[model samples]
Target: MDAVQGTLDELGTPLSEVTFVVFDLETTGGSAAEHAITEIGAVKVRAGEIIGEFATLVDPGGPIPPFISVLTGITDAMVIAAPRIEAVLPAFLEFIKGTTLVAHNAGFDTGFVKAACAAHGYPPPVNPVVDTVDLARRVLTRDETPNCKLGTLAKLFRSGVEPCHRALQDARATVDVLHGLIERAGSFQVHTLEELKSFVRAPTPEQQRKRHLAESVPHSPGVYLFEDERGEVLYIGKSTNLRNRVRSYFTAGETRPRIREMIGIAERVRHIVCTTGLEAEVRELRLIGQAKPRYNRRSRFPEKVVWLKLTDEPFPRLSIVRDLKDDGAAYLGPFTSGRAADDARIALHEALPLRQCTQRLTERTRRAACVLAEMGRCGAPCEGRESPADYAVHVENARRAMLSDVGPVFTALEARMERLSVEQRYEEASVDRDRLAAYVRAAARMQHLSSLTTIPQMVAASPAFDGRWEIHVIRYGRLTAAGVMPRGAHPTPFVEALVATAETVRPGPGPIHAASAEETECILRWLESPGVRLVEVDGDWALPSGGAARHKARIEHAYRGLERRRAAEGRPLR
Candidate 1:
């Protein structure tokens, strides 16, 4: 009734206050597209009292089938003088205005109504609809009714009116069925129209009993935790409305097999209300990492993240490490896997002649050079073949390639690929091309992250539904805290409180912790989203000139062209 109000009011509207128009239809055939409505009947009721009624018989414009005439007792001759659907549909639509429509098999009845409206150049009613079939399924078990067909439900509920394949009588029967189901739903505390509509996926008896667990949760943005009987967290989630979201878990709306099982074991639903959706998201990440809930698959193992670290040495080398330290070494990732970190390492080495060896060397070290040194692929620092000054220059170039500038490295890789291609070594050229692409991707990511990490503080905001703004305060690429400001409220107080309460997180060499990587990526993703406004920045956040990102577009275009040519030539893509 009344479009079910908004989320807040709908949850509290009692069933007694809801107005319903129970309707039924007898059709010429099964499909609305191929047939027409023969009869229509509806009864509007409020608080158990009849307020209005509508009944009509329509001329089908064609002969009724022999079987239909026997079932409904309405033949062509009986409806010859009756008005057509064009006239009956308008009257029926008016009768059900400002009310929720109820029918035995609602889809069947509403489908014909919508079809008739479209055929006649009239807009159909947009009333909230309820199906008695769905309500019966939720309120009555199969053991009680065998099936939820309108006839079976009518007999089970002992309705005053019995269905007889006639419109008005069947409509009246559905009204009684609606009341009976409403009375049974009361046992589950489903007093509101929204509750009734959502009853199809009613929680199991245990979940229904634990509905009180969400009673104290405020109707605001927040994170919710579902815990099993042993008080161990089972699943963690976020919502714009804590009460509504947590309550939905107990309804049929939660259809995931795993979620259903989680709710079966869940004994409590706990929540942490936030001022804005942004805060809720950040908190969800933190809680998921802390609790490591069995149902959470992401950001749960922060300790397992890997990083690509540039070792601090006279002759620098790249290595994959699992831990981040306070040392002065440069780093590039909390890559999802060790293989990815290795790929990035190989790509960087292909572009710059940073040694591929693991040995730690000094200016006076005298270890024999490895095979890579023999090929002139390395500067041969291990054998002291290259002077310290010359090797220092290579190390500086590699450092710049990793942290800021990457044009020279890309240029070198491109030259190597061209030379290989001219020599008719297509496969070798392909390998070098892949290495260049991988290095470019990793370099672009590092440059972007470096720009954000260099900033001391920054504030970003995005408009949300209902005139609310989601505000986020980021420090060193990590979201330190977040807040929400209402339509007319001043954001100054909220911003101050959030910044004061914000956690102090130092940027990792490469987000070695999953929590650090997950949070930073989350903030970066949001900042890149369309319509996100940068509200304030305490320091300059700018990417370096001649960085990897500058060439990424051109490289992608060329990559696509190469792929198309290989496809046309029927070459193996691998």
Candidate 2:
């Protein structure tokens, strides 16, 4: 049953003549302009048969945010040695040169890729795109499906495919789902590039409703709800553009089958516009928890898996408990996995001299210490020689270290060793350095932690001096700040100040809006002066004290205050 050909109209040759490149991308965020892609997975299909596949991590020329790293398991280290997009994209383009792009959610992935390519001045892709999502919606009855999530559809069709967030696996899964749908439908049509483009009618009434809903949606910031015919929530999402976000579902091509089904059933849409993106995200998370939408997969449960805590008994036996039970015990495992908890317990026990036997401690009892105690590894609590109270104190200190500042301390210790290396102190510093590195490695293995900084209102916005025009700063999403700079402008003190300022930046006015070339040059020169000040430099970026100890302390206080203020007010950081 070659459904690829069978599903198409007679105007089209057998579907075997058609080719598709199933692709997926791991990115920093949902927005194409704001986020970046870290990895790409692709599989080629020709005539209903898999031909070749490719997957690669690409250096996005920026730090991979911790949230993204946690979600994708693609860390900065994994991409550090990978080729940059500029070096890899051309090769990728060649690989899929003549094939149609096929993605579960095609628009988002393709839109992002287009943006990335445009940023680097590459020609936009001319190949056609086939959305599995659109096909499911057009063929399946909305009420019967109720919801069309990739996972749900896979289950509905009894496809027996495992779901993962990975790019290639997902792309392949989408292909499988499409195959299953085509075989099941028995009656459907697949159009070629030219025919599809020709028949692509004006946005349907459903599409118009979505467009109007999107247009009416306040662009300020908010969460939107997509509901099916039965009034059951199909999906929950938040966006800075409420209307655009909702309309996205209607314009679907490469969306997941479940989402396509959801859109098919969607008889109504509603939205809540917020004051900011951060607020919208928080509200969305809360709403997802409250609604527990059938299509949503993320867990809302606060309790992650428990870890094992040791040092309860004389042997400090490992046990899995949510919290520490009593006074004379420092416990450890309440970790996600028992194996992980056990590994951590072993590391802790090795670091401290403790009885490794499964024996109890009693006052006045004497027995041969276990190997750990015999070898100076354990403070022989098994023989009742080491006071439980003293042992508990040690355990508490170790537990605190593991919980809080160990990683930073380890890093500092290594840096100190590196500094000492220049002074010929390697012999003395080597042991401590090795110990510190081991500790850091252990901490990393435990669970990589990342700090969430206040999302900056303005990031590095200017293109590196490209000899074309002056740079300008935009404020509150408006073009309030502007300055001119010559092509290849050197970084002077005022330029440094402008760059360091927390002000939002935007592109300069076009030549049509310019007064004169020389006038523009003059404005650029003025901006270049050390006396110029743009928006008020907020916080440490504006600080002029050269970062003395007091300045550092003040900055720390300000950051903590800001964090607390946001927490208390339930406000997103500005």
Superposed on all Cα atoms, model 2 deviates from the true structure by an RMSD in Å of 16.8
On lDDT, the candidate that comes out on top is 1
Any runs in candidate 1 off by more than 4 Å, and if so which? 1-218, 243-261, 406-439, 464-470, 486-515, 550-574
lDDT of all predictions:
0.75, 0.54
RMSD of each: 19.8, 16.8
Against the true structure, candidate 1 reaches a TM-score of 0.54
TM for candidate 2 is 0.42
lDDT of 2 by residue, 1-574 (tens): 6555544454654445767788878776666776677888888987668899988888988886433443455667789998887887887788789888876657767877898789888898988886555555555654556544566566666665554657777777777876766554445344344444322232344554545545566665688877777778767888877876666766733234455545556767778876444446556766776776766655333244444455544335545455434455443323444555555555444455445565566655688776776677677775776887867765654555444335334434535554555454645454443344334333332222111011122212233234433344423222223344456556464455555563443323211111112222223333345534443323222211221223223223323322332232121111
Full-model lDDT, candidate 1: 0.75
Q: Model 2: residues >4 Å from true position, as ranges?
A: 1-14, 19-187, 191-219, 225-235, 264-275, 303-397, 405-574
lDDT of 1 by residue, 415-527 (tens): 77666654656567666666666667777776777667767788888988788888888888777777667898788887787788887865444423224556666677789
